[model samples]
Structure formats: C-alpha cells, structure tokens
Target: MTLRSRLPELDDATMSAEQRRVLDDILSGPRGNLDGPFLAWVHSPQLADHAQRLGAFCRYHTSLPLRLTELAILTTAAWWKSQAEWQIHAPIALKAGLSESVVEALREGRQPTFERSDEVIVHRLASVLYQHRRVDQATYDRAVEAFGEEAVVELVGVLGYYALVAMTLNVFEVRRGDEPLPFDEP
Candidate 1:
C-alpha cells in the first residue's frame, strides 16, 4: 500500500517551541531522529514525548535479553503485517543474535526452528498473546518459568508497546525503508 504521510517532517523553523523542545530531546536520545512513527507523533507533542519515553524503556531498559526482546518485536511485527515495523526490527533482531532462519520463518508466517529453549518460550508467549489477544495459562507459566516473572512482565510490555507501534504504522501507512517486505501479503 502506498501511503502519503498526513504529517510532514517539522523543520526546526516551523516547529512550535514545545514541538522543537520535544524533537530536540528525542534527537539527543538513543533515537537520534524524528523518523518513523515519531514523525506522525510530533503532531501531538505530549503524546510524542510520552510514547517516546515508553518506547525507550521497551527498547532499551527491558529485563529480557536483547535476543528475546527482538524475537518478541519480530513476532509482533509479523502478526500485524506491519511493513515498517518489520523493516525496522528485523536487522536489529539479527544483530542481537536471533537466527536468520527463525527471523525468516516468522516473516513468512511459518513456525520457526528455535535452537534455544528460551526462544521457543518467548515465541510461544508472543504469538499466543498476539493471536489470541490473551495468553493461555500454560504459556504464561512456561514464560515465567523460563524467564522469571520480571522478564515476563517486561516481555508483555514489549508486546503491548510494539503492537501500538505496528498499529500506528499500519494505520498511518508508514512507508517501509529500503529493506524489502519480509513476507508475502495475503
């Protein structure tokens, strides 16, 4: 789908004082650009600030290992068929040690072959949560048992945050980057 962004990139000269402050803060942080959803979010400066903060925690401060975190993100992106999210997160998943085969399986909507028991548990939890909108007791128990309650909580937070991002990207018709679409659309 071709999408024209409803919100244009706000230049420093065009921004309100509040928008400029928020944009500058985001630029100085780990996310060094007002790219992706942030471009749209800048339309609502308060929401942009809060969402970016939450995104930072989900992306950086989470208790789950980076591999598991990226796995959850990829699963969320694939579930939503969010091209922008998939394009952004897939490389990060690989860089964080997720196997190419597993990333490909999730991208193609196939069951992945996970070498680690932890990967299996994380994938199960994320998939069940996304598909069913709630995880069954067994999956929740397995996640907690494997990763501990804290990490499980953080995993759920990641799922929720990414789901929001994926929905926003899909709704806004956010364009994908140079990377090709990861899966065939139905």
Candidate 2:
C-alpha cells in the first residue's frame, strides 16, 4: 500500500507562540530535529513538550544498556509493523551491538536467536508485553532477576514509548522519505 503523511510539516513562521516554543525546544534537544512523532505532536504543543521529554529520557537516559534498550525498541517496532520506526532504529540497534542476524529476524517477524541471557530477557519482555499487554509472574521474575527492578521498569518504558511512536507513525502514515514499504501490506 502507498503511504502518505496525514500531518504535513508545519510552517514555522505561521506557528503560534506555544507551537514555536515547543518546536524550538525540539530543535535544540538531543534529537536535534523533528523526526518520528514530533511533527504530528506539534499540533498539540503541550503534548509535544511532554512527549518529547519523555522520548528523550526513554531513548537516551534510561538505566538499561543501549543494546538491550534498542533490542526492546526493535521488538516493539516489529510488533507494530511500523516501517518508519524499523528503518530509523534498525541501524541504531546494529551500531549498539545487536547482531544483523537478530535485527533481520525481528524484521521478518520471527524470534531472534540471542547469545546473551540479557538479550533473551529483553526480547521476551517486549514480546510478551506486546502479545499479552502484561507479563506473567514468571516473566516478571525473570526480567527482574536479569536486569533488576530499575532497568526492568525502564525496559517497559522503552517498549511503551516506542509502541506509542509506532502507533503515531501508523496513524499518521509517516514514512522515511521515498523509501519503499519495508513490510508487505496485509
């Protein structure tokens, strides 16, 4: 299926004070530009500010290791079949030390083979969370044992934040330029 953005980029000069303030903040932030959900969230400047801050924390400051965090993000992206999310984060995940094979398997919607126990926990946590909307007691115990309570909580935050981003991208039909669809449409 051909995809087009539901919300076009807003013209800066025409924006309200609140919108411009949020836009400027996003521009100066670590993200350095309005990518992913920011353009869409800009329509609601309050939401834009809050979501962008939360996104920065989830993507950058979370207690979880970058590789594990990216693993969870990719798992969430694949669960949502979000092409933009997949394209944006796949390389990041790879650079953070996730194997190309693992990224490819997640892209293919199959369980990836993980060498590390932490990787297995992260992928399982994300997968079970997406599938069941919550984890079972055993799953919870395993995650906490593997990553501790703080990282486990951050892992959930990463999964949830990326899932929200996936939904935004899906709802807005956001794409990374003229790239062809990554997943076959149903």
Candidate 3:
C-alpha cells in the first residue's frame, strides 16, 4: 500500500530523505513491518526524538546483555499489545538470544517462565518496574548491586522508553505487516 492510502491519518507528506528511507524499508516488509501508523507517527518531530533516544539508551545503558535487554523490550511490547514494536523487534530479539518459548509467552501476554535464572530475574524485575514504577527494596538493592548503579539506572531508563513507545503504538493504532509474528521461527 502506498503511504497515502494505507495511512490516511497522516496529515503531512514532507518526509526527510532519511525518514523516507526508513519508511520505505519498513514498508518493503522483507523481515517484518510496522507498516503505516507507526511510520506516520515517527515521521513526526516529537516521536522521532523518542525513537532516537531509545536507540542510544539501548546501546549505552543496561548491564543486562543485549539478549536480556531484547527480552525485556519484547515482553514490554507484548504486554502493551504494541504490534509495531513486536514487529520491528521480534526477529532482533531472537537474534539477540530470546528463545522461542519465551517469545511466545511474551507474545501471548503472560509472564514468561524463562529457563535461565538471569532471564527470569530480568523479566520479573522489569515487570515490577513497568507495572509499579518502583521496585521493592531487595530487588532494587540486588539489581543495583549486580549491575552497579549506572547500569541499573540505564536498564530502568531503557525499559521506561520502550514502555512509552508501546503506549504510543497502541494509542495511534499502529499496524505492521498483516500477519502476526512467528515467535517460534528459527
């Protein structure tokens, strides 16, 4: 679908070349998609900042390995039913080391029963932070102690960003490719 038809909700047409390239890539749908609404929203100035900050935060913060970080991100997306996020990230998450079973549980909106102790800790820890905005003393102390203060701060920051992104995707009714994710795909 052309950008005009698929996303009539879009009120603007002036896309930066960089933005246009990204949009075209998303639309091409080779890997998966976040086809229309999300593309449209990110074209906006405000959401663009949020998107950029998230990328930087993910790379620089979080002592939870990229694998664990992706798991946290995927679980947040799934919990919020943010298809745009899940679309863009599921394959990336798999590549980063989230297993099929954990992805499925996340996609199905359940607390994933992760096999690894560290995965379980991150999942449970992230869940509490997102759901409550505060962690209990022990969990907080443990994570901060395990990851150190800076890393823990970064983890919370990264998770917070994704949580906000999920909210936007849901609010704007973003649609990726028509098909749901093959969470089990290798």
Candidate 4:
C-alpha cells in the first residue's frame, strides 16, 4: 500500500492551515500529493518537525550544498533500487541542476562521468563507501582532495542514512500516496 493510502488521518489539531499551505507549497507539482497516505506520511507532525530541524541543520552546518546533498540522496536511492525513493527525488535532483548525464550515471552506476571534479568525487566516494563500508586511506585521501575531509564524512553519512531511509520506506511499504511503482511494484 502507498504511504498516504496506508496511514490514518490525523486529528484536526494535527494540521494547521499554515501547515497545509506549507505542504502545498512544497508539493507544488503533478502527482506530488494525490493521496492521503502521502500527505499524512509527509505531514506527520513529528516528521515535519524533524524536517524543519534537518533543513536548518543542513542549510547552516553541512559542508555539502543542498545540490550535493540531493545528489547523494538520489544516487543512494538509485543504487538501492528503491523506485519510490528514486521517483520522489528525481525532480529534486533536476531542480538542483544535475545534468542528464549525471542522472544517467547514477542510474547506470557509472562513476566519474564526464570527469567533472565534483561529480567524480561524489560518485567515487559514494561508490567506495557503498562497496567498501570503510574508506581506505587511498580512497579517503582522494575524496578529501575532492571535497575535503568534512564533506567526505558528511557525504558518507548522508548516503548511509538515506539508504537506510529508502530501505525502511520500502520494507514498511510507505510509498507516496498514489505513487505506483515506476517499474513493477516491489
């Protein structure tokens, strides 16, 4: 079942007019909020609170730009073969200006596409971290060279966390409301 379709409706106190407006603003596109499960899943008060907090943290503190964070999110989702997660993030990825080549590379698991420094860095570092679990000195040095030690750490952390989120959402069957699988339903 899809997330919004599965989740029960919240109490009237759970969603304010302002909150609904914010949700509408964030969704602002086709099929983005076509179901209650998705609306409830995303609008759950706790998650909304956490998202607000996470946004502030990421905006102010992370070494990764929002685009870079989105890259890590979408790539990890693709790597995990989580269609729901991928569909959710694809527009965010494009909105961040990641080129078609980069998106294809993430889908195809092709790293270092076009040899641009950041793409190479994110792809390679994410790949090695995904594959190796622990970055060896060589990989670490290269990643640090590409985006400093802090970014490398944050990138891995973000990728790992998003991978976990993707798995949880899939395993728990928390799909966006009306978000049928782009491929077959897993």
Q: What does candidate 1's lDDT look like per residue over 1-186, in tens digits?
A: 232355575676788988888888898999787556777777789988999999999999998889999999999999989888888889899999999999999988899999999999999998887778899999999988998899899999999999989888777777744556666655
Against the hidden reference, what TM-scores do the models get? 0.92, 0.95, 0.72, 0.67
lDDT of 3 by residue, 7-119 (tens): 34432365666666554554454323444244555466466544654555574455668887888788777767776678767888898888988888888777677777777
Query: Whole-model lDDT for model 4 versus the true structure?
Result: 0.63
Report every candidate's CA lDDT.
0.85, 0.87, 0.66, 0.63
Q: Which whole-number lDDT from 0 to 100 does residue 144 have in model 1?
A: 89
What value does the lDDT take at residue 38 in candidate 4?
A: 38
Cα deviation at 109, candidate 1, in Å, is 0.6
For TM-score, the strongest prediction is 2
Query: Which of 2 and 4 is the better model by TM-score?
Result: 2
Model 4 ranges with Cα > 4 A deviation = 1-9, 13-52, 55-61, 108-112, 179-186
How far out, in Å, is residue 56 in model 1? 0.6
Model 4 poorest ten-residue lDDT run: 29-38
lDDT of 4 by residue, 147-171 (tens): 8878877777678667765665565
Could you give candidate 2's per-residue lDDT for residues 120-150 as a string of tens digits? 9888888888888889999999999987999
Identify the runs in model 2 with alpha carbons over 4 angstroms from their true place: 1-4
Looking at candidate 4, what is the lDDT of residue 57? Answer: 51
Worst 10 residues of 2 by lDDT: 1-10
TM-score of 1: 0.92
